[model samples]
Structures are given as structure tokens and as C-alpha cells.
Target: MAMGNSVKAPLGHIQFCEENRSACRGRDNSPVVVKLTEARWNELIDLNTRINRQIRPVTDEKLFGKLEYWTYPRGGAGDCEEYVLEKQRALLAAGWPKSALLITVAKDVKNAGHAVLTVRTDQGDMILDNQIEAVLPWYSTPYRYIKRQSTREPAKWTGISDTRVTTVGSVGN
Candidate 1:
């Protein structure tokens, strides 16, 4: 998928990271405006690039092991969950609002399990995945949504796959 199409979402419709722009004016203090700044947005992009280096794609010959919500620092190689979890932690350290980061699962190009990040901004939803460094829209990603866990609970998020997707609840629930 083209990076331009994904990143070029309607800024008016989604949360956006505006640094020099004064997007927040009152006490309501929307989390999106609070977490994402122009500087932090750039940092997320940079961090995503750095994390991509650790990703080793899942292949039959590569060997594998079981992973779950409790495994900390899943180590050198991981499936989508570990990959996205690490990136989420990096974003938090960079000062991006934790609320802005979403741990989402989508159908991979092969119609298998896959994972990516969903960042909500006043501009729209921006997707960040090791597969692509541009941080495009979730829709722009080739994967289709199977599940999404609020960034607030990265480690707490359970089962993120097509099989469990059918039984999961909505974000607000």
C-alpha cells in the first residue's frame, strides 16, 4: 500500500499532533492534544524506525515459541504482539500520550495474523508498523482490523488474533 494514501487522512476528523499550533485552549485537556506534539509525532516516527530493526518475520524455518501478555522483553525475535508492545513502550518514554497509542491486530497480507500500531490524532488514525516506517492510516495498512486494545493497557491486553477477535468487546466496554 502507498504511504501517502495512509498518512493523508482528514486532519479535521482525527486527533493530530500539533506542536507550534495551539490546539488545546481549555481545562478539558483532551488526551490526544496532551500526548501528541509535533515534536513527539516525529519522535514516534523515528522510534518506529529504530524498533523495526529488531523484528524478525515469522516463517516456518525460523522456529517459534509461545508468547502471552505476561512475557516481559520477549527477546530478539517475536511475533506481532511483542513487536508492537516494545514500540509502545518506546513511545511512552518519548513523551507521547499513552492514550494515543493503540495495540491493534489486523489480517496480514497472507490472510494470517498480524499486528500494528494505531495512533489517534485530531487529524485521524495513523498506523505505525515495523513493516512500514511512514506511520500511515490504519486503513492504509494492508491488514484488516481483527482486534484493538487501548494503549492504556499494553501488557494487560489479552488475545489479539483472528480467532479471539470474534469474542472480544469494544474499546469503551
Candidate 2:
């Protein structure tokens, strides 16, 4: 589906993006146009599962005693955005193209804001969510898609056009 134009990121995400500009910057600031192999797919799934299981979920208010949105590579506990940042870093370190890994924000079934890592592959755009153990296509998730980091520029973000409700399912990338 064609996505909407670029949009402003959430305040918290904006803060995180600013603080970690160097980390987010990529050698090539373009969308991924390659297909992923089965081995690469398995590696991504393993990394997602490992980080999700390793990091205990904690709200920013509880952890910081304030409503702040920041992303970091936390070892023990962190919120959704932190999880996404960690996964993105790991994938990049593992030699995955930066354009393929995007940090995305969406609303959950209850309309609560959430974050997930969107992996763009030749097959489709797949999501690695902290709430679910499995990697699934972005369209199959329960969340209402919103904006995601722009492929042309990691610092910029674009709005998503697909708002169709999808049943939760596992789909390989």
C-alpha cells in the first residue's frame, strides 16, 4: 500500500532521535530493496526473541518517575521504544542494511501507543513487536499502523495509509 506523507514523530521519540543521531545515521539513507534469506530471517527472529525475553517491561513513569520517551540499549528492563532501539542496533551491527530496519510507532488494540521495529524485506514489511514473540507482516498485526521512520531519511518519519483492522497472525518475511 502507498503510505502518506512524512509526519512529526512523537515527542519522546523525537528526544530519543536527537540524543542518538549518530547511531541512527546510516551510510545509505534509502529504502531497502533486497530480499532476506532464510538464515537472515532466523537471525532476526532470534534477536527479537532474545531481547524481548531479556528485557523486563517497565513503564517510563515507573522507571524514571517522569513521562519521558527515550531509546537506549538497556540490559535488564525498558519500555517498547528501548526494545526497538536495541533490536535496531543489533541488526545494524550484524551487517543488516540500516534502510531495512525502521523504528515504527503504532496504536494497540486498546488505542494505546506502542513501538515496534519494522523490517523491510523484498517479501513484505515485517514487524518485530515486543508484545509478541513471533515476527509477522506489518498488515497482520493487531495494532493500527501510524507513522514510521522514513526510508529516505532515518531522522524523518512518514505516515502509514493502511488502517484496516487485521487479525493477529504469524507470517514469515
Candidate 3:
């Protein structure tokens, strides 16, 4: 699916980017338009599972004694954003194009802020969420889709029109 116009980054995301500027520096902002091969899809699933199993979810308040969102986990545990970061990193290291992998923020079914990795594939936009093990189409989730990193610019982002999407499987924090 075509992405929407650029939008402002979420406050928490901005903070994470600022704190991790060194790592994010010089990142390519071009959109990823490549289609995923069968092997690539398997690899993505493996990476997602590895991170999901390895990183135990912890709240920002508990981890930092305050609200602090990090792009990647500094320790063994982290929240949603960190999961997305790790997955993105793994994909990048595996030679996946930076343009195709995006960090996305959305509101869950309960309206709580959540993060996930959005892989831009030729078939469609697939979401790799910490809350769920199975990778699914972006439109299949119960989230109130908010904004996602711009395909043209990683630092920049674009707004997503909210739709009444239904949850297809078990709920996750």
C-alpha cells in the first residue's frame, strides 16, 4: 500500500532519536521498495522470534524510574520501541535495505501507545509486533494506526488514517 504524507514524529520517538543520535547518524532515508523472497521472509520471522523470546518486556517507568523510551535495549529488557529497534538492527545487519524497514507507533486496542516494526514488502506492509508472534498485514491488526517513519526519510514520519481494524488473534501488551 502507498504511504501517507509526512507527519511529525511522536514525542517519545523524538526523545529516543535525540538520545541515540550517534547510532542513527548518517542513516539512509530512502524508501525500501523491494519485494521479499521466501528465504528473506523466513529470515525475518526468525529474527522476530529471536528478539521476542530474548527480550523480556519492561515498562519505561520501571526500567528508567520515569518515562524514557529508547530506540534499542541497553540491557536485557526493554519495551516495545526497543524490540522494534533490535529487529530493525538485525534486518539491517542481514543485508536488508534500510529503506524497507521502518519504526512505527500505533495505539493498541485499549488505546495504549505501542511500537512495532513495519517491513515494506512488494506484497504489502507487514507488521512485526512484540505483542504477537505471527507477522501480519498492517491492516489486519486491531491497532488504531497512527504514524510511521517516512519511506523517503527515516528521521521523518507520515500520518496514518485511523481505521476500525479488528483484532484477529490473542491480545498482547
| Runs with alpha carbons beyond 4 Å of true place in candidate 1 | 1-37, 58-64, 67-74, 151-173
Clashes of each: 10, 0, 1
Runs in model 2 lying further than 4 Å from the true structure? 26-29, 165-173
Error of 1 at 49 (Å): 0.6
Q: What are the candidates' C-alpha RMSDs?
A: 13.7, 5.3, 4.0
- Which candidate's lDDT is highest? 2
Say which prediction, candidate 1 or candidate 3, comes out ahead on TM-score.
Answer: 3
lDDT of every predicted structure (CA atoms):
0.54, 0.83, 0.81
Q: What is the per-residue lDDT of model 3 for residues 1-173, given as tens digits with 9 covering 90 to 100?
A: 44577788888778877877754545564555657889878887888899999999999899888686675776778999889999988888888877788888888877898999999889888999999898888888777778888766567888887655464677789
Cα lDDT tens digits, model 2, 1-173, are: 34799899778877876788886565564466448789988997899999998889998888878677677845588899889988998998988887888889889887898999999988889899899889998878888888888887787788988758566657898
Per-residue lDDT of candidate 1, residues 7-79 (tens digit): 2212211221232123211222344533456886787678777777766655322433323231113346655
Q: Please report, as a residue range, the 10-residue window in candidate 3 with the lowest summed lDDT.
A: 22-31
Q: After superposing candidate 3 on the true structure, give the runs of residues whose Cα lies further than 4 Å from its correct spot.
A: 26-30, 164-173
Q: Candidate 2 — which pairs collide?
A: none
How high a TM-score does candidate 1 get?
0.59
- Local error of candidate 2 at 154, Å? 0.9
